[model samples]
Target: MSLFSGSLQKYGQIDILVSNAAANLSIDPIVSMSEKALDKLWEINVKASIQIVQAAAPFLSDGSSVIFVTSVAAFNPGTGFLNMYAVMKTALLGLTKALAAELAPKTRVNGIAPGFVPTRFSAFLAESAEILAEIESKILLKRLGTTDDMAAAAAFLASDDASYITGETLVIAGGAQSRL
Candidate 1:
C-alpha cells in the first residue's frame, strides 16, 4: 500500500485501476494442497485485490473504472489442479459486484475472465505447440487469447464507450463456456 500511496502522490488521481496480480501455485486436490500454498493463493488472488481497491478508492472518483483480470477457471473448474485458483477467482466475481454497488453512480467495477492465453502465466498448461493447439481447439475461435485482446477489453471498459456498463464481468474466453 505504501507504494500505491506513493504512486498516487506522484501521479495524482487515477482514471482506471486494473488489479491483475495473481500467483498460480501448484494445483492439486483440495485435501492434497498444502495450507501454505492455499494461504498464498488467497493472499495474492483475493486479499490483494481487496487491499488494492480500498487503497485506490480514495484517489478514484466519478467516471473512474476498476478492472480485475480473472480467469475462465472461476466458472469452469480445471480438471482438479486449478481448484484453489478457481475458487479465489470466483471470489473476485463477488467483489466486483459489491464494489460496483459501493462505488456506483461514479466509479465502475468489472472483471475480465480470459481463457487459455499462452502467456508465461499459463505456460504450465500450454508447454508445447501440440498441447497449446489441443487447448485452442476447444475454443470456438480456435486460438489462444492474446494480451492485446485483454487490453482492448480493458480500454473499452475504461473509456466512455462503456459508460453504462458496471458491476458486470466481460468474458473474453473466445466463446468458451464461462457461466457459473
Candidate 2:
C-alpha cells in the first residue's frame, strides 16, 4: 500500500480506489480457534481495509468509486469456517453504507461479494480436479468464478457507467442465493 501511496497519486487524481487486498485461511471452526488467529484475520482483512480507506479518503475525488473486494461470507456467515475473517467481511457492508452516506454525492463507495472463485483462498474447499465439478453442481452456472468476472464488475462500478449507483454491494456469486 505504501507503494500505492507514494506513486499512483497522479492517476487521474486517483478517482478510483480498488480495495482488493485480503486474507483468507482454510476452513476452521471457531470453537477451537485461537485468539491469535482471530486477531490476525481482523487486522489484515478488516482494519487494514478501513485504514486503506482512511489513507485514501483525503485524496479521493468527487464522483470517484471505491470498490471493496469483499466475500459472500459476509452474508452467509458460516463465519465459523473462517473465524474473524468472515466477521470482518460482514462488517464491510455496514462500513460501505456508512462511508457512502458520509461521502455521498461525491465519492461512490461500494462492495463486491464474490463467490467461491478458483483462487488460493478457495483451495481449501477442494483439492481434486473433480472437486470444482462437484461444487459447481450446487451453483446454477455449474462453474466456478474468475477474477476477470469480478474485474468487469469493478470496472463498471468504478467507471462513469455507474454514476447513479452508490452504497450498494454487488454480488458476483454465479447465481448463488443471497439473503442480503
Candidate 3:
C-alpha cells in the first residue's frame, strides 16, 4: 500500500495497473498445508490484488487498463503440488470477471496466463536445465517463455489495440493447452 500510495502521490494518477506480485509459499499436499502458510499465500496472491485495485480505482477512468497476472494453473486444475497455487490463480480469474463488470465502460480489466516462464519466481521449475527442457518440450512452441514475451502481450492488452477487449484472460503460454 505504501508503495502504491507513494507512486500515486508522485504521479497523481495511473494509466495502467498490473498486479503481478505472487509467491509460492507452500508446495505440500492440502492435507498437510499449514494454516499460516495458506493465509500468507492468500494474502499475497488474492487479497493484495483486491486491495491494489481498490486503491487504484479512484485514479482510473475510461481507457485505463487493469491487468492481473494470473497463471496457466488457473485453467489447468491438476498441476500436481500446485493445487493451492492453481486455486489462487483461479480466484484472480473470478476477480477479473467481476471487476470488469463493476468498472465497465470505464477502466478495462483483464488477465494474462503465462506458462513456464524462466524467472526467479519459478526457480522450482527453471532451476535445472534438464527440467527446463522437459517443460519446454510440452509447449507447442518448443521453448520456455520470457518476461519480454509476457510484457509484449501486456503492452498490447494495455494499449488501444485491446480497447474492445475486457474481462478476458489472455494465455501467453507458448501454445500450452489452457482450456478449462
Clashes of each: 0, 0, 0
Number of clashing pairs, model 1?
0
Off by over 4 Å in 1: none
Q: Compared with the true structure, what per-residue lDDT tens digits does model 3 show for residues 1-180? A: 544677677777778999997987888887799999899989999999999998889888568999999999899865678888888999999999999999998999999999878787888776778877778778999988899999998999999999999999999999988878
Looking at model 2, the pairs that clash are none
lDDT of 2 by residue, 1-180 (tens): 653566665564568888876786535677666777777777887787788888887777878898888887788776345655677788888888988998888799999998878787677666877766766776788778898999999999998889998999999988876555
How does each model score on TM-score?
Answer: 0.93, 0.88, 0.93
Return the clash pairs for model 3, or none.
none
Each candidate: what lDDT?
A: 0.87, 0.79, 0.89
lDDT of 2 at 70: 86
Tens digits of per-residue lDDT for model 1, 8-120: 77888889999997898877787788999999999999999999888888889679999998888898765557888998899999999999999998799999988877788
Who is ahead in lDDT, 1 or 2?
A: 1
The residue-level lDDT of candidate 1 at 76 comes to: 71
What stretches of model 3 exceed 4 Å from their correct place?
1-6
